[model samples]
Target: MTSASAFWIAAVRARETGRGAPLFIDPFAHDLAGDYGYATMAASERVAGGENAFIPVRVRWFDDLTMTSAAAGVRQIVLLGAGLDTRAYRLDLPADADWYEVDRREIFQHKEPVLAEHSPRCQRHIVIADLGGDWAEPLLHAGLDPAARTLWLAEGLFFYLTEPMIVDLLHTAAALCGPASIVAADIIGTAGLDAAAMRGYRDWCDRNGVPPPFGADDPAALLHAGGWRAEHITTPGAADANYGRLPIQPGGRQPGRTHLVTASLATS
Candidate 1:
C-alpha cells in the first residue's frame, strides 16, 4: 500500500473496534476503509498483536470534542492533515454546516476516488494541498468564508511537523478564522518522545516509509503563543473519563503526556 493508503488502513482498524457499540461508533469509517483497501490493514494489525489499539480510543475522544464544539455554535469544520478521516461522513451536523478536509495531493488522490464511490451524508468539501506549503490559499479560494464561525481540527498531524511548521499552520488558521473560532489538536509532550515511545514511533514510521518529526514540550503554551487561547486540555485518562471508558495503561508504546487540546482564536 502507498503511504496515503496506509493512513486509511490504520483508521479502519480504529473505527471497527474503537467505534463499535460501546466506543465511538463511526459506521462510515469502517465502510470507507473496506472500500479503500483498509480491510487488509486491519487484518494485519489483528495478527500483529493489535498494533493500533489507541486509534479508536483517540478518534472517539476527538469525535466527541469536535461535536461538542459544534454544539456550542461552530458551523464550519476544517480538518487539517485529514488523512483518510471519515468524520465528515460519519458525524451528524446541521444541514448548512460545511466540512472542509485538507491534506496532501496524494492523500486526496487516494481518498477522492473511494469517497466518490460512497458520497458523504453531509456537506463535504476536499482541499488538496500540502500543509507545509501554501495550502491555505486554496482553502480561501474554495469559499471557506473566514468570517464565519468555524471549528478546525488538526488531529494526528502536529507531531509529524516541525516547530516552525506548526507555528505557521496555527498563525495561518488564526488569520483565516473569525472570532469565537475553535481549533482542536492533539499533541505529545517531551516525555512522550522518550526512548521507548520514540523507538515505537520510529518503528512505525520506518514501516510506513516516512520520517518522524519533533514533538512539543508544552503545546498549550505553543498554541497560546500562536494567538489562540487554550480552552480545554484533555489527556488520555481525561478523555477516557469524558467518554466513559476505563483508563488506558499508563505506559504504552505511544508517547507520554499526549493530550487533546481545544483553543479559541484570540480576537485582536
Candidate 2:
C-alpha cells in the first residue's frame, strides 16, 4: 500500500469500528472512502491487521483538542491536507461554525461523489488546490474569513512537505489568522527519526510507494520562527497522557521520529 492506501485503510477501520458503541464514530468516513475506491485497495490489507493502536490514539487526541478549542469559542475549522478525515462529520460542534477542507484538486475531485453521497454533519466547504501551489487563495475564496478566529489542523500532513514549504505554510497561516487562532499539527522529531522507529517508517513508505518528504527536528523553533506561539507541545507520551491512551511500544512507534504540537497565535 502507498501512503494514500494506508490512509484509506485507516479510514475503513475507523468506519467499521466507529459505529459499534465506538470509541468514536465516523459513520460517513468508510462509505465515502469506499465510494472513492480506497476500500477496494484496503480490503486486501485488512485481514493482516491487529489493532492499529496509533490511529485510535491520534484520533482521540485530535477529538479532545478540537472539543477544547470549540469550547473556547472557535467558529471555524480548517483542515489542511484533509484527506479522508472524518472530524467534520463526527465531532460535536456549534451549528453556526464552518469547516473548510483543503487538498489537491485531483484528490478533492475524487471525493466529490463521496461528498454527494454523504453530506457532512456540519457546515462544510472544500478548497481544492495543491498546497505547494495556490491553496491559500482558494481557502480564502471558499469563505474562510481570515478575520475570524479559527482552529487550523495540519494533522498527518507536514512530513509530506519540505522544511522550507512548512515554514512558508506556517507564515501564510499566521498572516491569515486572527489573534485567537490555534494550530494543532503532528510531527516527527529528529530523535525519533534517528531511532529504530525510522526503519519502520522507511519500510512503510517503501511499501506504499512514497518517500518521506521532510521533517522538523524542532517544532518549537519552526513555529516560533514562523511567528506563532508554542502554547503547547507534546511528545507521544504527553499526548497519550492527555487522552488516557498508551504510547506505542518500541518499534511499533513509527520510526524516523514523531511528535504532536498544538500552537496558538499570541495576542500582540
Candidate 1 is scored at a TM of 0.81
The regions of model 2 sitting more than 4 angstroms off are: 1-6, 12-21, 35-52, 194-211, 239-244, 247-257, 266-268
Q: Candidate 1 residues 161-226, lDDT tens each?
A: 777788889999998888889888878767756545356556777797765756775667789877
lDDT of 1 at 28: 46
- Across residues 87-203, which tens digit of lDDT does each residue of candidate 2 receive? 776778777779999887666665677656655667899888777777888999999898889899988778677777787888888888787799888886656454443465566
Per-model CA lDDT versus the true structure: 0.71, 0.69
Reference-based TM-score of each model: 0.81, 0.79
Index of the highest-lDDT prediction: 1
Q: Can you give the lDDT of residue 240 in candidate 2? A: 49
